[model samples]
Target chain A: MIVVLSGGVGGARFLQGVVQVVPQQQITVISNTGDDREFYGLHVSPDVDIVLYSLAGIVDAANGWGIRDDTYNTMQQLTRYGNEDWFLLGDRDLATHIHRTNLLRQGKTLSEVTDNLRIQLGLDLRVLPMSDQPIATHIQTPAGLLHFEEYLVKHRSADDVQDVVFVGASKAKPAPGVLDAIKQADAILIAPSNPIVSVGTILAVPGIHDALHEASGMVIAISPIVGGAPIKGPADKIMRGLGLEVSAIGVTRCYRDFLDVMIIDEQDAHLTREIEDLGIPVVVTDTIMRDDETKAALARTALQAAGLTI
Target chain B: MIVVLSGGVGGARFLQGVVQVVPQQQITVISNTGDDREFYGLHVSPDVDIVLYSLAGIVDAANGWGIRDDTYNTMQQLTRYGNEDWFLLGDRDLATHIHRTNLLRQGKTLSEVTDNLRIQLGLDLRVLPMSDQPIATHIQTPAGLLHFEEYLVKHRSADDVQDVVFVGASKAKPAPGVLDAIKQADAILIAPSNPIVSVGTILAVPGIHDALHEASGMVIAISPIVGGAPIKGPADKIMRGLGLEVSAIGVTRCYRDFLDVMIIDEQDAHLTREIEDLGIPVVVTDTIMRDDETKAALARTALQAAGLTI
Candidate 1:
């Protein structure tokens, strides 16, 4: 099994690349649930769905989230109900959340519900939540601590982060098969997701970081940050808030203890020596995957960095 | 205030009449919840939604249920997951169920959630579920006991029902304002709905029957059966399952104790003497409301039976 540690859009896009280079059944994704929230009573798993849609080849390439060509009739109606429409939920995407929420209400764990959705979406790769338990991400800002979604979506991530908290993570147990996938993997790749709230929150779940630390297989992570900024999202501002430089070297420092290899974009080739100084192997390549071909090529490079052929 | 006891399609149509005849704020509907079930963990309240759609004038006129022009794309996709599509939930209708299910999971009672939906739907009339508790109508057939929707929708009521069980009725409490509506009503009219499942289930709720029986206002019922058959739905077969004749006289006899007046179809005028013989006043008219004009005329006749002038 090739287990991938993932977040939302960035991670989902990278997982799409990985799938292109590997058999569906050979992959397992341990997704971050920190961005998950209950809106109007529906459980919204932003990261899991992004990955699911991306892997299924139905993600909106232009927006990098939601289904392609999905209508917004439901969201428009929800707005008529006086619902805040800052976070856009397409009609087709609403169905997935509805199904997930319904299953969760029936007492099915997130893992089981996700499995059902994957099967329904005709996806073969296993997508597992980092933990079955609720782990909400909160950002302490000038406006007070807001839920991660509120900061990222409702506020458009315009607020500066003062502090971050992974609520419920202290007691959350990893979802079933997550630890096993990491332990039995030929290699584990941390996708180019936001390190602070995405991959960081996944590692916060009890026994997960430990499992990676003790993994028998090689662990490689592509830097979400390239040169001195995030390729996408608010990772740079968030990293700066945490008093860290936004660069490949900074990303390597975060995962240095567990990651065996760190990959950086060719633009950050000058920082290769600094990343290698962390005592982790370095792989320099053009890591920005703009299309399917490039994504698969990046995936191949990451696997090769772990001493495996695609 | 005018309180109408209702079921689904026939009931929604009748509610359209009642709302047309009376001021919206003065109309309150106590909808049957016996057909309510958790479909995929969604608190599916078919009767409440029908009444809501009808009162809002957005009901699918052809089906007499669901939102007008609603699509079934989500339900069609649900089939790919091997889900049985016996319950035909339209995409727009699915949004309502999804929202309701999510709220219920968040610990909101059915009554509260229903009120929220009513307001959201822009319905002027008060649409209330008979009770917040589950009071499923189970049909005991030659094959086996089936849920009310399963028998009504899936099998199209083809199975011979041996018995009808209002499961949990004895333990269910009337929804908030239900008994109060009965007490404050100028008159209460039971619509031409399924006697066994709809009106029967409402009376089955612990204190509802007694409240209706003792109310100071006149209690009238429009017979679903005309001549010797139901104008719509399976009330005829269901009444027969309970060993009752499918006639206006039989309907009068079933409700004689609490009924002050019983409205029969013009075709059943010959049986008015028999119904009167049972000591219940009778008003014979065209009880089948096929259109807005007919529905409004039916409402006027029903009100006249209760000695109310429109």
Candidate 2:
């Protein structure tokens, strides 16, 4: 089985490629839940929903999040009701939040709710949240600490991030089957997602980092940074604010403790030597996924780097 | 002040007429809350929304409920997620539910939330739920007891209603200002609504019935039944199921205890003398309000019946 650590849009896009190379039944995704927050009292797991929508072929391809052909009628009406309209919630996309919230309130854990949703959406692969307990990614800025979504969406990530705090991470237990999936997997690939708030928050959870280190399979990571910049999102700004190098080498440093191989873009081949100096093998290739062919190729490369035949 | 007891669509239509005759500031609508139910964990008050949307001039006039031009994207997506699709929740109308649910979770009473929504919607008149406590109107059918919405919307009222049950009425207190509005009103008008579930549910509340009976103001009721049938909804069916006559006399009997005057449609003028025998004065008029002018005329007739000169 192949286990993937994923975040939002970029991660979802990467997973689409992984599915093309490997049968979905053999894959298990441990999705980032730090981006989860309550919008109008409905629990919204942004990264998890992106993965679900993308895999189910319902994701809005242009935005890489929310369902395609979704309407914003609910959000528009909510705005009319004087609700804060910073986070846009599309009408069709709201079904996931509403269903998940209802299930959670009924005493089902996030993993159980996700499993039910995946089955309902006709997905065979498993998707688990990093933890069952609420863990919010708060970015400390010069202004004040803002929830990850508020900083990324509401403020457009304009604030300079001084630090990132994973609230409740210390007490949060890995959701059921998350650590088990990592332990039993033939290989684990960390998707190209924001390292600070996405992959970083997952590692902050109590047993998740230990599971990655103790797993018997080769651990591979695809660098989110390409040519010293993130392909999407504010990974570059956040990495810089945290005083980390904004390169493939910086990504390697973040996962150096458990990472066995690092996949970097061909544009960052020059940094291979620095990445390898951290005792992680570096694979250089064209990682920019512009189409299905390229995405499939990138997934194959990451899998092969983890010692998978396919 | 003119306090109007209301249910859903028919009552909302009557309220539109009430507003045309009386200034909005002088109106207080006590809407039924027993039709309120949770859909995917979101509190949906169908009756309350109808009154609000109608008075704000944003109602879908064709349907008598929901906002104009509302979409059902959310309900469609929710059905895809394996949710029961019996109750139709429009996308734009979902905003009121989301906002109200969020505020209720934040410890605000239903009345407080209604006030906030009213102000946001630019409404001047006070719109109060019958009670702040949860009270669901259930129809005891031959098959089994079903929620009012289920009986009406889901099953299309196919089963014979043995009786109507207000689940929380005995213990539920009238929402703040409900009884006070009745006691302090210059006149009270019962809108043409479903007496069994809408206005009936409001009156079933603990103190609301007594307040109407004890209030010094004249109480007037416009028959929801015109000739021997309701203008809309399953009022006649439910009334017959509960063993009540499906005519103006049956409606007069429902409110006979507190009713000082009865307003019947021109079609029901033949029953006016029999209605007067119950010690209630009768007024005949063309109660089918097809336009604003007709609605204004109906409102004037009801007000004048309460000894108010238009």
Candidate 3:
């Protein structure tokens, strides 16, 4: 079985590749929940939905999140009612939050709700949330502690990030099957997701980091940084905010202890020996996933790196 | 001040006429909340919304409820996720529910939340819910006790109703200002709505019926029955199920206690004397409001009947 650690758009994009190389039923995804927030009082799991929409082949390819051709009629009306519409909830997208919120209010765990979504979406792959516990990834900014989305979406990430804190992760256990997926996987790939908040929050869950530390399979990571910057999102700003280098070297620093293989772009080839000096081997290739071909190629490389495809 | 007790579509249509004669700010609507139900976990106030949309001139005239031209993208997507979509929730209309639910969750009374909607919709009048307390009008059918919506909307009012019940009305207090509105009003108009579930549930609230009984205002009612049938909805079926006559006299029988005058359609003119025999004077007129002029004419007649206009 192949297990993937994911965040939002970037991870969803990389997952498009993973599903191409591996049979869907044999793969499992552990998604970040730190970015989950209530929009209009309905629970919205941004990262999880991104992965779900992407793998189900319904994600807006141009934007890389939300359903394709989704309508914003609800948001338009919400604005008319004087609600804050800065988060941009599409009408079709609102259904996901509604279903999730209803199930959660009915006392179902997040894991169970996610599985319910999986079955409903006709996806064969398993997608486990990082934890059932609510975790707010708060970005300490000049604007004060902003929820990650408020920092990225509402504020447009304009404020300088001062620090990042996973609010509830310290007490959170990994969601059911999360630890087991990592432990029994033939390959555990960390998708090209933001290291600081996305993957970082997942690792912060009490037993997850420890599980990876003793995993029987190889833990591979593809750096989100391409040519010294993220293809999308505020990864570079956040990495720099944490007083870390915004490069392949920095991503490795974040996951070095548990990582068996680190994949970097050809642009960061010179940093290979430097990354390897810490005893973690680095694989250099064209890691920027521009299309289906590039995404599949990257997935093939990650699998081959774990000796699953060789 | 003019106070009108209202239900859903029929009341909304009648209010269109009332607003033509009376300045919006001069009118107070006591809308029934017995039909309120949670659709997909969001609180949906059908009667309240019908009133809001109608007065705002955005109501779907054909359906007599919901905002005109509202999209159904949310409901479409919701059905895709396996949720029952029998009750149509237009995308724009959902914003009202979301906003209402959010405020209600934050501990705002339904009255306050409704006032918020009123102001947000740029309305000048007050639209008070029947009570701050929730009173579900359940239809006890051979099938079981069904939510008013489940009975009317989901089941298409197909089942034979054994009885109708206001589940929580016995303990429900009249909302703040409700008793005062009835006590101090110069005129009280009961819009054409279902007497059994709609107006019946309002009267069932503790103190409200008593307040109406002692009201100093000339309490007027427009019978929804015409030609021995209702203009819309299951009023005829439910009245028959309750073993009451489905005619103008039947409507007067339901409201004979507080009513000083009863307005019946020209088609039911023959029943006027029979209704007036109960000590309630009856006015016969064309009560089917087909257009703006007809609606205005009906409003003028009701006002003149209360000696409030020429």
Ranking by TM-score: 2, 3, 1
- Compared with the true structure, what per-residue lDDT tens digits does model 1 show for residues A120-139? 78989899999999999999
lDDT of each: 0.87, 0.93, 0.91
Candidate 3 chain A: 10-residue stretch with minimal lDDT? A301-310
Task: Show where candidate 2 strays beyond 4 Å.
Answer: none
Candidate 1 CAPRI classification by DockQ: acceptable
lDDT of 2 by residue, A169-229 (tens): 9889999898899999999999999888899999999888899999999999999999999
Chain B TM-score against the true chain B, each candidate: 0.98, 0.99, 0.98
**Clash numbers, per candidate:** 0, 0, 0
lDDT of 2 at B72: 95
Q: Interface Cα RMSD for all candidates?
A: 2.4, 0.7, 0.8
Candidate 3 wrongly placed segments (more than 4 Å) = none
lDDT of 1 at B64: 78
Best by lDDT: 2
